[model samples]
Target chain A: MTAAVPNAFDDPAYRQGVVELLGLLAYGEISAWERLAEDAKMAPTLAQEAEVAAMASAEWEHFAQLRDRLFALGEDPYAAMLPFQPIFQRFHARTQPEDFLEGLLKAYVGDGLAADFYREIAAFLDAETRELVLDTLSGTGHSEFVVDVIRDAIAEEPRVGGKLALWGRRFMGEALSQAQTVVAERDALTAVLVGNADRPGAVMDLTVIGRMLTRLTEAHTERMDKLGLAA
Target chain B: MTAAVPNAFDDPAYRQGVVELLGLLAYGEISAWERLAEDAKMAPTLAQEAEVAAMASAEWEHFAQLRDRLFALGEDPYAAMLPFQPIFQRFHARTQPEDFLEGLLKAYVGDGLAADFYREIAAFLDAETRELVLDTLSGTGHSEFVVDVIRDAIAEEPRVGGKLALWGRRFMGEALSQAQTVVAERDALTAVLVGNADRPGAVMDLTVIGRMLTRLTEAHTERMDKLGLAA
Candidate 1:
């Protein structure tokens, strides 16, 4: 008979949960790397390809860092990631970018939520692992690219504002939907953010979550306005 | 009325051919980054993701270097790259990898041929361009992955020999077919490798090309055999 897999909801779950989450994140980074790298082909200039390629490399580095943390936790990173494959795959399928701008917006909005989620979880981790996740989140290139492309597109064609603004909205909606699914399906993962013994405010309710999301939305809107996409 | 677009194959063509080639190469590198990064998700451990992510990152760096070289030549890198989009997109459609191993093998064999082609073209370029191309070709991570995966797979499953060996054959056949198409359709690109100034024994001909193919085939065969797939 096959052995039943250990549930990570317990302290026994620590090793498995750490490994699995890291694997999932590593895979996410990997997919992001490939998307950005390949999309660089759509770039109109050699210089642009270089810029996108560099950005894609940052995703790969993030994957590496997460993988390293998984290793430190004694997780078999690939096995840990295997369970969530369909989930991540479905999310990507539902949100496939149609063009260069869509691609950039996907990265920008998608990584923003990812960073927020990781920040929440990092507080549950030991110092070293938390530091690694923090550093990885800090290294995001999506915002820079998003700001540059939106500004350029607006500067070149003021008519792009209506289309891109709508596209940005769709991107955010899809990303938030996937994040909610992730949180709902994984209670232990939620515990990483909400069950901390040391801090009373470590866990937040729906109102606080809504406020955070609102702030992010406001920032994104401001960025769009700065790029003349929200005139 | 729109001005006549310059034919790239014409003598004294205004389009910068070298930069165009670099754009294509840089795009390929970015695509490689994406493929490898995504494939790393199939890994069974975090360490494996790290290994694959590092490989993906290397592809990005290669694209960066090629992009810089193109910029130095005073061409608008994007404009140079625009002509070959359809062809590249078609190649990608026809040759999508089915799995992690397939993706890695694609990188290994496909990029190896591309590196050889780049080296041949480098020989035809002036001193600076030659050095730049050579430097870009030197740091490929594809072969190392190929060797590692093939070796490990063979060690783990002695019976996987036939499937993988057959897959290797398909890889080479598809690659060579696409290469021929590239050579036939891209005349100036052919000129880049065939040499602007002919020298006896400097440029490769059909016989020399055949010999090189034979070598790569032999190496691939040896790899398959090492993985216990020779039967």
Candidate 2:
């Protein structure tokens, strides 16, 4: 049993931080949806395109849920998402996938990274917001599809694995750089992560934050390994 | 009450015709989904992009339903869709939308044309197949959104109306030409339309087919009128 509106919302800063986090998450979904849809265009076959398109639709559905939550919180969803657009745009621009395999690797690796980071942040959020964040961040149930496709491709051509492995590293680098920019610019979101003075119980100390990063990296490595790509 | 599988499907030729028709319709949806997703990228704003993305997802949903029906009929969904892919590809290649407004108009008017044509064909189908065809052919509910957006744009720049009107005509021309090629090449699909020797009752004579064409054209004109464009 949980409160529909958490007591954490009583603090104005906490509420603002949650709103910013939701905005970021929602925008991330929209960005993922757009990129996946674009990747579907380069799919090698119609069946593969449909699979990617299904993933895109799943992302859109998650975005809609986050958007509705923003509305319920009395914020303009689009306006909330506006500030983070350029960060994602730059990340996507710098890491544009050159082919179908690159696209699959990016979708799997990039999304895995974002989901890990968000799950860490969800730890500091109120129950309701945490639940929403975790639920939406859950994979679109296509990770196996990506893993199978990439593993088969790599098996067919040993050289392709080397290229995709390098691609994964580049995607992670770009994602982290963009993420750091967001953290530096968004005080409210940073407060949510490290926990502000108003939310003493949620405080994550420097060591804890460091450990979170290690966990994220390890998870990413595991995903890359699953795809037969080096981290 | 309707039969789960129509008695009409008992005839091998009729079954082949329906399978071919479903293949064509499913492929049309996948094609529309791809094009709509492309159109979303050209959207002027994030909100508009989401709207278009929603329409794309709607198209994908229709494709899934049709694909499932194909599977139930012991057909490979992708293989069913393959034969008609080139026809749609050619149609899309010739009528590529040049901008945001053109994309919107193309989505609205082009889908309207396809929907009208399919509905006419649905009349010749058995009750179950007719229901599926009609259900999927139904608009994605974004017609009003497209109408409002295009109407506002034309209002802002009166010249846009003239340009879009011409664009509308070009889309219709390309669609009709591709449709002609399909009708000429697909003997089974044509059999569905004209009523084959085996199914005397389902046979639509030349006059009826001509009237169906007239109705299709009138619907297209009405849809164009709704968009404040000439048919």
Q: Weakest 10 consecutive residues, lDDT, candidate 1 chain B?
A: B6-15
Provide the DockQ value for model 2.
Answer: 0.79
Clashes of 1: 13
Q: What proportion of true contacts does candidate 1 retain?
A: 0.52
Error of 1 at B110 (Å): 2.2
By lDDT, the best candidate is: 2
Q: What is the lDDT of residue B215 in candidate 1?
A: 61
Worst 10 residues of 2 chain A by lDDT: A197-206
lDDT by residue (tens digit), candidate 2, A1-231? 367844888887788888888889889999999999999999999899989988888898899899999999989988889888999899999999999989988888877887888778877788888899889888587888898999899999999999999998898778767766876687777778765626555544556555766788799889888787889
Model 1: per-residue lDDT, tens digit, B122-226? 766766667878888877754665778766876787665566667667766765676667666665555454563233334435565456556656665665554
**Candidate 2: lDDT of A124?**
78
Native contacts, share recovered per candidate: 0.52, 0.78
